[model samples]
Target: MRTPASQRALLVKISENVCYTELVYQRVNKKLSVDWSHSETEAWVQAILRDPDSLVEQRGKNYYVANQRRKSQLTVNSHNYRLITVNRLSK
Candidate 1:
């Protein structure tokens, strides 16, 4: 099992190369209650991945990046690094 630090490092390293499909983009924004454009939403997700306090976990084929401060979790494909979606954590 990869440690949290290693998972975080690997995820951040691939952040710049990740892909965001239009379908997932719309899905993410709807789930997260955000109206950001494609670029803005991608940047927001990347920021969460790079945040020092964020926790990363791998389950099945997906990487879950969760940030307490942001109150959201971002899901990305482990193999292709394609952003799957994001969800806001309930307060």
Candidate 2:
């Protein structure tokens, strides 16, 4: 298991390298119900990943980042840092 400091560093690195495809952009917008541009969406996701309150964990081949303040969770490919999807958390 990684130490908290290492895990946080890893999350920061992943956040810096995160990428999004057109399909993912569309899907995120639909799921999150916000029509942000590609760059805007990317920034939003990165912010979540970098947030100290967010929880980052690896499951299988993906990194799952969840933030309660944002009320959402995001999944990214571990290998390529490609954004897979994001979903709003239900209260």
Candidate 3:
């Protein structure tokens, strides 16, 4: 499990590859019924990256997941983030 602080840092490192459009942001908040901050969104993105198979499916360049898991705990799906690239940032 990743701490929120680490997740925030990771999000900053991958900010270039992440795309959360206006529509996507709105939809995510609507779905989750919470006004999520950028940190929250980043955390969700990290969770999704950790488990790509959990995604519902790829709709074009976007990946959708109805829910996410932290370890074995389930969480509500907030939004889909398009990963523009998959470079090895770390080993």
Candidate 4:
């Protein structure tokens, strides 16, 4: 079982991205919008949505999520979203 604070941390870590928070809020306002602050690093995520398909195991570290772009779509308009794609860049 996860404590309230721990759960909050996990949610914050996952949704550090703003657009993502807004997306969730739009869908359901139950619990997940209390700590979606605006981060500059995460801002780029919204501006440029990048989703990698693979994880880079370098020095025993999953570099995929580490270097992931935290972004999400807030627009409910289906016409605006043609397709969302993420490219994996590993070397």
lDDT by residue for model 1 (1-91), tens: 6787787777676576688899998998788777889889878877887788888788899888888899998888989988888888875
With candidate 2 superimposed using the best TM-score fit, by how many Å does residue 30's alpha carbon deviate from the native? 0.2
What would the per-residue lDDT of candidate 4 be over residues 3-73, giving only the tens digit for each residue? Answer: 54554443344344323344443333323233434353245333332333212221221112223332222
The parts of candidate 3 lying over 4 Å away from their true place are 1-16, 52-56, 59-62, 66-91
Worst ten in a row by lDDT for model 3: 82-91
lDDT leaderboard ranking: 2, 1, 3, 4
Best by lDDT: 2
Q: Indicate whether candidate 2 or candidate 4 has the larger TM-score.
A: 2
Model 4 Cα displacement at 3 (Å)? 0.3
Question: Candidate 1: deviation at residue 90, Å?
Answer: 2.1
The TM-score of candidate 2 is 0.92
Model 2 spans > 4 angstroms off: none
- Models 1 onward score TM values of 0.87, 0.92, 0.41, 0.21
Q: Rank the candidates by TM-score, best first.
A: 2, 1, 3, 4
lDDT of each: 0.82, 0.90, 0.45, 0.32
Runs in model 1 with CA error above 4 Å?
A: 1-4
lDDT of 3 by residue, 1-91 (tens): 4555664444444333556556655655665566888668667656655553332333444433322333222222224335332211221
